[model samples]
Target: MKQGTGGKIINVASMLSFQGGIRVPSYTASKSGVMGITRLMANEWAKHGINANAIAPGYMATNNTAPIRADEARNRSIQERIPADRWGTPEDLAGPVVFLASQASNYVNGHTLAVDGGWLAR
Candidate 1:
């Protein structure tokens, strides 16, 4: 994007970026770094017409979490915490991604939008 002098950069972060989630300290740290770097990029690159942002997705029913979903206890614990009362689907991210990339969110830069089902509110 810097070389091109203008572009949209969308990064994938996680709810862990804001919280010290259980059992995966490294994951939490990595996501936090993603959040920081996204903002740094936005600050430096917005002048070049580059919009750098991140999406912090909550628990989703993707294969990446297949094992956790397979485990009854872990699955129940996560669903209960989410006000949505169910796991999020990949489709849930469609709108947010579109907005970030489209002119609709042109003014939105360096923002890490949490697509959690009110998980952070709890």
Candidate 2:
């Protein structure tokens, strides 16, 4: 992308970047790398009109997290930890993604927007 027309690069990151799961070492490491790359690319491309950012989503009730949600106790515990007191929905992240992709956020760069129902705040 750097060599092509200058453009925005949005990275899909996860809340795991801020917190670690008990048994998911690789997932955690990968997300941390996403954040690192977002920052690095943003710094390198600022002068060329290319923006880089990341979106870190919380436990959305998606196919990937269905197993966790299916466990009643686990689901309840997860909800309690989030300030919003509920699981996130894919729709909840749409606005952030749109904002980053549009000219409305031209000044924004190297930011990791968390659509996690305030999970990281807890």
Candidate 3:
């Protein structure tokens, strides 16, 4: 990006980055690394007009979580935990994505915005 037109790089992280839950060692480590990398890259490339940031999303009902969502008890448990009273949909994430990709976020860098429906607060 340094040699080309410098732009924004949005890293999609997970809620796991902020807190470690049960039975997911590798996931926790990987997400922690993502937060680190986002900060490092932002600092390194800021002078070149390149912004790097991360978005940490909570439990969303996507293709990757199909198996988990398929189980009745597990799915219910997940929803009950979320303050929003439901799983997040793809549409729930679009606004933040658009803001990050647009000029409105020009001053934002190395920040991890959470779109977790107040999951962290709970």
Best by TM-score: 2
TM-score of model 3 vs. true structure? 0.89
Query: What would the per-residue lDDT of candidate 2 be over residues 1-122, giving only the tens digit for each residue?
Result: 54776788899999987777679889999998898999999999988989999999999989989999999999999999999999989999899999999988899999999989988987
Pairs of colliding residues, candidate 1: none
TM-score for candidate 2, please give it.
0.93
User: Where is model 3 poorest over a 10-residue stretch in terms of lDDT?
Assistant: 1-10
Q: Rank the candidates by lDDT, best first.
A: 1, 2, 3
The lDDT, on a scale of 0 to 1, for candidate 2 is 0.91
Backbone-clash count (model 2): 0
Instruction: Give all candidates' CA lDDT scores.
Output: 0.94, 0.91, 0.90
Model 1, span 28-101: residue lDDT tens: 99999999999999999998899999999999999999999999999999999999998989999999999999
* TM-score for all models, in order of appearance: 0.92, 0.93, 0.89
lDDT of 3: 0.90
The clash number for model 1 is: 0
